[model samples]
Target: MQQYLFFSRDISWLGFNGRVLQEAANSSAPLFERIKFLSIYSSNLDEFYRVRFPVLMALANVPKPGEEVTDHRGILNEASQLIARQLDEFGRILQEDLLPGLKRHNIHLIYKEPVPGFLTGAVTDYFYTHVLAFLQPLWLRDYSRKFFPENNKLYLLVVLTGADGAEETAIINIPSDALPRFISLPYNGTQYILFLDDVLKLNLANIFKHYTVTGSYSFKITRDAELELQDEYEGDLAEKIENQIEKRDLGLATRFLYEPGAATRTIFNLAQTLGITSSNMVQGGSYHNLKDLSSLPIGTYKELSYQSWPSVSPKDFNTGLSIFDTIKNRDVILHIPYHSYNPVLRFFNEAAIDADTEEIYVTLYRVASDSRIANALISAARNGKKVTVFVELKARFDEANNLKWSKRMKAAGVKIIYSIPGLKVHAKVALVKKKNNNRTEYFGLLATGNFNEGTARFYTDHILFTANPNLVRELEMLFIFLGYRQHADKYPALQFNHLLVAQFNLQQTFLFLIDREMQHAQRGKPAHIIIKLNNLEEKRMITKLYDASNAGVKVQLMVRSICRLIPGVPGMSENITVTRIVDRYLEHGRIFIFHNNGDTELFMGSADWMNRNIYRRIEVCFPVLDATIKQQLMEIVQLQLNDNVQAVQLNQSGENTEVTNNLPPIASQQEIYNYVKALQA
Candidate 1:
């Protein structure tokens, strides 16, 4: 027996975020893009506090039965230190680089300074007019029940003193949600942007007319976002989820982030009264919610941003034939964000009105707010076609949006299926059945991302349109199982030869594939494995890959975040290499390739090798049978692997090191865009 090593999932995730910060610090990136990376880092940290931090705290409190307790406290401390350093770097980039860069471009962002003398009048006027109506101030002592700091909502704690020297505190909300976080004012032939916090700071005298404002500190409390749902086989799950969404903000506070320079007594008092533990107290910069920096008014300074690459229309879908007819002839694949998403939209729009169409089945995880796909389904139902949509209401943070779409679709005659009792249907597949001249034709759409066109604009994903009956039949079977909405174990055993579905054959088939590669290596034949995913944390799958690595099968992984397997470890994973890329678009597609001696097998789907995906959810991974599409995927992945710029190699300790060599620089996103555009030409 050999002892294996794995990186802590939380720490590995932090390392991924560190890579994002690196992009922010990269002087070569566009100024606005760097600012955007800062915003992304802030947003990612907030979610980690809301979701993962609570788990860490809970784990620290639990004691093992026989063995020593888990050192969750140590892990938490390490994570905290990493976060503090990252935040320091964040401030450095914002103050030292981004702000000065904006200044060079004739834009002034009022950060920690007082309002410019010329702009004071304009700031006060805007505050009294646009910002006054939403202001609600409460005395911290008097409004105990009336005010609990809502999760992640910004507020200023004002320490006030009467004329007699007696002091008290009041909290006023910063209405960034109601208004823009950055207010732009042009003065003295220069563009000036001010944080809403500063505007409120300048106008505090108007709000508290009688008190002498001694101190003010900005702070926000991040609450746990996990929704606890009862496994009730009886009631309305949608209604239950809706209720939970309403209560999400009121969960236990996981982080109490307050601006530095607040008195120790004041910080502790605020924490005590607000139900926040001292452990949750974190001293931060003057401005919290820097994620709002995404909205910084840089105006039309095109030079401050990356040159936009307009999405190209895929040549295969532009033959002027109907989308169904085109897919009926051969399999079609779209590399999204690089390729225009109009064809995907047209796929459903045509199905809604196509007279021969009789039935449609699909699974939706995260639905766009104004989903054209959902609307098309509603229309298809109205046009007398049977439309069944399995809407996963359990998608984190998007539960409310999904539930909203579910209600509208149900009311419009589409048969909407809610989530199973203990399983989330995360498969992104759609089936369209048509009856033409007493012949039945099926068109299936499978994707490595959500069906939401909104996300497709910025998330790099792949969508496959095929008329293969083998894959379509397996997809139909999965949808039928989802319709039951029972516990996964209660469903009948399903046999899928063509599709790898979780909770059934997904994990097993993946293990079997790795085993085949190991066997090939044992026979002294060429063997290799290539995979790309958003996350890879499933232990069994990783161990199997380690087995393959030890057996001389080369493994290459492009994991965007949260990879646990330690690559380049001697005799364990020495043959495995992990590469991470962060660039203009979010890398999101899941691709897996196996070198079966001389024959290569390729797959792309919605599944990531995570515990929840493999054991607790309904996921689908499908094979790429079309030779042309397979070759294209292989070529694109090779471009990514060869990338020197915007790509990093992860070592055994999970640290991201720059991918450097004597080869010429290759930014894969740009190269892939050129590749796809050339194909169009």
Candidate 2:
């Protein structure tokens, strides 16, 4: 076999971001969706800097960890170059494609302007009434004592000139949260969309009357988001989390973005005062914070956007019988976004009201801001049913929201479990126990995504509702372990035969499955493997996959974010191919399928192939035992494989190229919706 090493995940992640940029640049995509992609790209980059970029910065500050380590500064510098190119493409797309595309539909987004003379009156009124109240200007002469820009907030550095020719610098904060990012102007015929930046720019002198405005340049800062929780797993987690969140804005600045083509004097002066160096300074378009473009109100020209795909109820879940009764006999699997989330919600709501229900168990890593699941759990506790919830306080950006929900659940009599010091309960599972007719039964749910209803509308995930003794008993044991009923040291005795759990048997089980496929290949029988995940960076797992490829096993992967595995190399991984799909719905589910000599076994759950998932976090991967559900999942994967739209083939070169063939166009997200609808029919 040819020699190879895993690609750097940070660089591979940039390749994934490039795929998002590809959608923005694709002419086949709808105009507004293209705009939304730009927003998505910017938002993604902001997060990368907040969360991922710091690792490189830390490495840059210190020496490299190992001989095999990729150059941290080199990768970051390459990222800088990649981002520059992507931003240039973004500018061209907005200027050449989307702007003109919107104009063809009679919607105008005004960027560069000779402002219409007739609209000055409305602009003046808006400035006085809506924008002026939030404006606070700080004179920079006292810069050392009282000037700090909040993270990710847009601001303007204005060079002020007095009549005597002396000048001073002042900083003004843009209150984007208080006012709409795009304001509609009073036009008799043509629709005019103006950014709040230009509105402020046009009226800059008015806001600062004491000095003549020599120049105004826009800029924003991004700060490091990782809150180093010092003391191990001992203290008040919620308090520590809340304290960290309160200090998030004050964290060290990671990126300093300035409007490209801004005055050098203003840029240098502001950068020096803000302690920004060349490494962190990023030159952006005339406006910053364009993620707000996703919310542009174009209600009159809705036809310019892609047709919406409505969520439909699954065929197996629509029976008039109670959901509990339905799951008690046969398993029910749901494809979220394509299928209605009502059954999952009904699981909790029904449990809150069911007289036989004795307890509800849930593990929530991240939940929706206005979570119906949280409300239902609270209701269950209030209705006299015992509810034990594990709210992981260390769930990254969602820490504050989880803290709030945990407090509410705690107040309602629900038992709350905080994050373990060394681990995060990343599993998404829930169990409801019922004592009916002098028999105790368990109805359990295990999902690939969080119990967040808001995200369920746009995140592709699978949840299985089952009463199978094999799956539920193991899940019960796992829950007892989480609830302190069983000691952590006794994790080995559970003997999980049906479930593949992380930190225990998940890795070994997957390796064993690959070995089975290898044996099938050696025996000259049909053998293949299909896996999907958000990331693929586990070295040992990748090596196993390489071994499978060399053994004549056909492997296909759909890694959405970070993929370090190299595919399609002669004699190394020539039998393997990889692709990624980014569309209206995010590809969030993790699925593994092995061809067991024509009897295929399928599984789906919360774990990706990342090292953190395999060794650090609590994750679950359960089998799709029902034949019909297994077939459905197989069809879903096949459709995604056949997708000609919104799907890109990835290669060892770290490039996400569009899939082109002679077949008809099939967008997997749309096809899956139609497929589920057909099943219901």
Candidate 3:
């Protein structure tokens, strides 16, 4: 057996998904929130199949570039097995735990088979009114190239028998998007829930009355979602992306999923007609695409869900002082979800109105549909302020939204920057320049998350508002590089000493910091490092950390997903410990703390410790120069470290064990909210 030195990226991602399942199983979490966790897990898995599974399939027959093992088929087999087990566990959680738990609270989630007498008549009426209008049944035998199944769309492969004992198949498209997945019953006093699957099953005869539908199996196809933007820099970038979007739904089939106990003949027919081999088919339970559970009606059971934690406004910059003036002399930090995003909004809104504001620049990777940020940029352009916005068309799954915004902004006199040749601007940064009497003053905002206000309410992030002259000057230089100078490598003269810009300085800076810690540990001085990222899979960085662990430096990692580093391995990473925290709010924001022997050096950024972030994308990691702000970040990180309730220690085997000990319960997300609230008070 040729063993790889690190855990496979896909396997590690599965481990992260497993942690999500653990969230659903957690009894301390509220009931409806547990259901939401299941939804998150399903949604996460759906994306994995659409995005990562195709790569696995393509790599199955071909060998990788620098690999020791080229067993992609073997890897795919293992993935299918793991998913089967997880789905079984998922079914158990919904049926055994969630459903029964709902019933105990006077709510009944009618899981599988047999719609009640009252709901049958009421739900059937619902089906006739809402669902029946959109139902389209295509005879599978007559299926051709014109009728390829779209990705992630639900279907029922029916095995039929004619009056003369002939066999046939038809595909019924499930109108999940048009109708709600969970249909609420009209029964008074007791709450009853019904799945769309059961309603369709009961009413199957109403649509296909001519044929004897013997075996109808529910399934959904996941297509390869990798968009091939050929010759990106050569020609119309937006047009190329638009063309790819048209073909996305019809991409290569990577997974053929069907409900468990689907008849062998039905499976065979589906396999042959759909080009799904035995290797591609996965057996799931009654339900598919449980991600829809996100919309599950909580009714009056708001108590069954996690209590709302309203965003707290940062009180450092008073309303009396202008946002620009406050940031002109000091650095203000906003820990989002805990801290309100209003000040960040105020930054741009004020820029739009300020008479002295000369120019505004922003890089948007993903913004909300009705983005107030986009609206602000348009308002600035209309106000005669020169504005340039970079709308990255290469943001996966967000191409269409980006293009729409790009068109709207370009029409509004804002200069729009589309995708660069091979690089995606993954940096979350905004810059504003004010023309003072004698000189030009710059105000810059660097963030660890997107500028979208919608996500700020749930996704944990760090945003720094600064008027630091040196940092702003470097940022101005980088924007010039992006707008006109062209390629990343073409600009080595770009000096970002105060900022860590990827491709130019980020990787090297991180290496230098790790090596310094290792050197200090070798000399028997106090040395340690705490790194927090959404993922940690960059091979070189993992190698550097392994070497540091060998040098007796203490290393602690809080990686939420896709961690390849094997912690606690004797002689390999014995001194390194890796843990994960998944709670009410998403655990995002990347924070790097290096114990500089005494004077602690810290960094927060949009980039993860992944290959794409380190080597490919244009990313920015800014320093926490302000002591008070740095102290706030340190406190937040410490709270996460001390989280025993929703935190789990990950072992080398990829199992997440809860951090149980003789200590008071601490859920970091909830604690951070209170901590910031107290600070404001």
- Give the candidate number with the greatest lDDT: 1
lDDT of 1: 0.92
Give candidate 1's root-mean-square deviation (CA, Å): 1.4
Off by over 4 Å in 3: 1-4, 485-492, 660-662
Ten-residue region with minimum lDDT total, candidate 2: 485-494
1-681: candidate 1 lDDT, tens digit per residue: 887878888999999999999999999999999999999999999999999999888777774567334578888888999999999999999999999999998899999988888898999999988999999999888867658889999999999998888898999999999999999998777899999999999989999999999888999999999999866645888888998899999999999999988789988998888878888989999999888988898899898899999999998988999999899899999999999999889999999999999999989999999999999999999999999998999999999999989999999999888888877889999999899899988889999999999999899999999999999988888877776545344665679999999988999998999999999999999999999999999888999999999999999999999999999999999999999999989999999999999799999999999999999888899999999999999999999999899999999779999898668989999999999999899
Which of the two, 1 or 3, has more lDDT? 1
**Residue pairs of candidate 1 with colliding backbone atoms:** none
Best by TM-score: 1
- What is candidate 2's lDDT per residue for 181-236, written digit by digit as tens? 98887487667888888788889889778779877788999999998886363557
lDDT (CA) for every model shown? 0.92, 0.87, 0.87
lDDT at 50, model 2: 89
lDDT value, candidate 3, whole model: 0.87
Q: Quote each prediction's TM-score.
A: 0.98, 0.97, 0.97
